[model samples]
Target: MPPLSRPPRETRALFRNAGAALPTRHAALLERCVERRLRGPAQVLSGHHNTNHVLRLGLLPAVLVGAVPFARLKYRVPRETVEVVPRIWPREWDVLRVVCRFLPEVPRCLAVLGDNHSLHVYRGGTVLSDRGPHGRIGEGLMRQFAAFFARTAGIPAGELPPLPEDWPADGDSDGFLRRLVRFTEERVHRPHRPRFGTLFDAVGIPEDAMARFLRGLHPLTPRPFALLHTDVHRANVVVRRNRIAVIDWELALFGDPLHDLATHLVRMGYDKEEQARMTALWAEAMTRAGRAELTAALHDDLGAYLAFEYAQSVYPDVLRAALALPPHATADDFHAAAHRIGHALSRAREPLRLVDVPPEPHLIDALRHWHDAQNNPATPR
Candidate 1:
């Protein structure tokens, strides 16, 4: 028999929706932004909301195209002219410049392609997430992270790069706190509008509770601030040639040094035993660095930051849970989303004044409605 004829090539779609729980755009502009920096052809590897469209060059180098904060909006809420403008991302680039200068366990930035993309000497490494670190929660991994943060803490503020224009000019710690609270309110909580508000209402978060919680959190002592990676979960750490390399500096912030420890303790998925060990290791390291004062109230104050983290997380968590459902979602999808969102709301209940976490069935209806609305062109914002 004659050989079967090969099919004709079909053009790829600019946007991909299938198999993706969240809506994602190809970002041809960003791809071109990276390609301009390369000498030859580069093949796209992967693309997602939190991550850039990764492209692999012929042999070694890889390019990353970044996405704006919450770029993948589930609900297209109307925004004022002021709200449409983007914040300065040069801060992250400047942060990488500082980090690579001091920390050896980070990818070397090759070029800043633009405000939203950068080229780095891609350290061919395995992301630790694939290794079941979250499952094992070993002491060795905790120690490694502890030491990394300690070394980062030692990088003097004077030696660090200058702050961006929008950052508090006076360097007031309270100013930074207020900024964070505003960010939580305006960026995370506000963007989804009526749905986000409705979710909070159903959960029973009091109108003024979040504000009161922010005010109640006052630092008891004076301690110097340090740079923090701010999102140090397993996915951000890569094991390259047996050395751990941290990536994704877009969320870097300067604040209470102890806040970094708190963020790590919560975000790293450490169990009770591992959390205790990690806390002790962090305290010991800071104590050795002559900053014992920084952690003086960690046991007491860390709770406040952890609460803030959980509270800030609820918006994304709920949206993500809802988005995880497919078109005409099955009962199993509803159950799964309910479990995840309910857990998030429970963690944030105290800080957000959530009187009660809603039951699974209610979440199912809320999520199903929201999911369906995302597909409707004329859905109310």
Candidate 2:
């Protein structure tokens, strides 16, 4: 399939939808923007996997800013890629439909444009990454985070989009994590193996790295599943009126709550003290929500999920760092990539059972060779 940035050759719409959910004026503006190529007030945010334009509009009385601090809308333009990593991609509009039915604090689906280019009401506030507490988000925000987790988990499965046929049975935590490991191996590593095998060997990432990680993994206690914003990093959070609005539902999932918590704990860039505090907060909130069973093995199982996260992330981190290099990469570029990949490898070492970490010179040489081969397929090293 062609990437989201490119218009398809054939004209079968992917995410076609009537703009019934949006306000009439908002719908008309979006229609003009997409159909008539009329650009509007917006801020284009460039990201590795997507380029999003956040529309800035006047906060008229009955506009999109009644409750929100300001009026804004954003359109998604997925970054071009060679499909290196697997994407869970929970149709953003569909996911928003479910969330909006429950949480008004969440964003809503405004419309789907050409090729289903996504347009949604943007939350107005500072993203947590931009202007917020770095390590610990204080007791108040911590409580809000906990409540958000519980509330999201409380969303019934029946309201969610249909799962894939092969999705793990509900609450099959072990199966879910194992499936994730297998996906990284089968979808990511294996397909690119021929191209990156030598590169992997040089970096000490054995072919069976994921397999080994899986084999050593112990089965997890079953936990009730819930909707998980799997990519709840600092950037995905928006703070307004002392409340946090989480955006970007593309990587959302329905799975064990602990996995969701673990992913958040890791990606929020929280220190050890904050992580523990957040874990406690989550436990309390789940109990208060009367879903104590979900965290029955919290202390024991949370680490496993954390390990899986670290283990799975290594592949994409290394690959993206490598792919980000310029065609005529300088020593500085190579040095930066080595640092990125090396950090990934270091994080994955225990989880992936990696030994003999590649020294700097060796890693530099490996990257040079890999880049050369990628640029000049006919030229033998």
Candidate 3:
């Protein structure tokens, strides 16, 4: 390997290859992380899919660097995605390389330890979730977000990675949205039904919920496609030096840019007024980027995407909420879990065409019953 830099293609190949070995220091750190022996200047963070540990790599053996460098190692696990976004291109590492080549605010992906693990330059900052910034953000920050959205939308397909044969042709907004809806139904729900099916039924989600939702979507207007950071919620955003940087490109995809906007608008927990403000900002930015066609369906198509987000999210939200119930959960725990599941189901009701959501008491009873069954699978009903 070149000491300084390698071509992007070679680098991408190296990162994608699961057989490749991590550097000695990185390898040691990964081993410690796997063994849960990580000590000194280390922090462990977990999401549904990956257990991430941050390590201070210090310095190169021969180099005279003054600073203690840091990198985050991600260990893969059986993660779930509620995005329902199509991943036609490569995942996070490549997305970062391509995106950061132009937009530097995005966290740089250093390397992939192996198939399921990755190393990223650990940018120092507090995650937005930790900050819990409520209400509208200032104009400057909003501009930065708008620019990030536009820049990502303008990325050329030629520069990234090869898309699958099933990917819709450019400007096929209809096809793109259809693929997403299909993914939520066929890819997400169908596969996990055997496991979460009962939980879903108890929550009043019918097997044909997505089918009914899809039928109500309006005809999509043609819009140019682009790369999207589909999971850009507060947790995935970092606030450093008065600027916000996006991380976790694992759910990144190439699709209708509005889908990206919709995801961000929802995930950020923006209020109704703030959502309108953001929509305006995004429209202006897209138009300025000479991608006016991308926003043509803003009035109607955006709602479809938002509905889709709420619709698909219910499956994961219900399953995750139920799974989160502790073995010996208290009444308060069950109440909290029930409230959470009720909210998700309530938000999803319109799109999914649910007849009625169970009351909190009913939800609590159902959850307890589900948890009991999970613990005592051998005992017949």
lDDT of 1 by residue, 21-119 (tens): 111233344345345534444333331223343444321111112212212111011112212112334345566666776786675544343333444
Q: Could you tell me how far off, in angstroms, the CA of residue 132 lies in candidate 1 after the best superposition?
A: 2.4
In terms of TM-score, the best-performing candidate is 3
List of clashing residue pairs for candidate 2: none
Q: Tens digits of per-residue lDDT for model 2 on 130-172?
A: 8754666788987888999998998989988888888889889
Q: lDDT winner among the candidates?
A: 2
Candidate order, lDDT descending: 2, 3, 1
Q: Total clashes, candidate 1? A: 0
Candidate 3 lDDT, 1-381, residue by residue in tens: 533322345445554332234577856665554445354545678876566776544334111111123334333332544434555544566666787777776656554555655555566788878876566666777777888898888888788777788788988898888888888888778888887787778878898988899789888998878888888778888889888888777777788888899888888888888888889999999899888888986988898988988888887788778778888999998999899889888988898888888999999988887888888896442
Worst ten in a row by lDDT for model 3:
61-70
| Every candidate's lDDT | 0.60, 0.75, 0.73
Better of 1 and 2 by TM-score: 2
RMSD of 3: 4.9
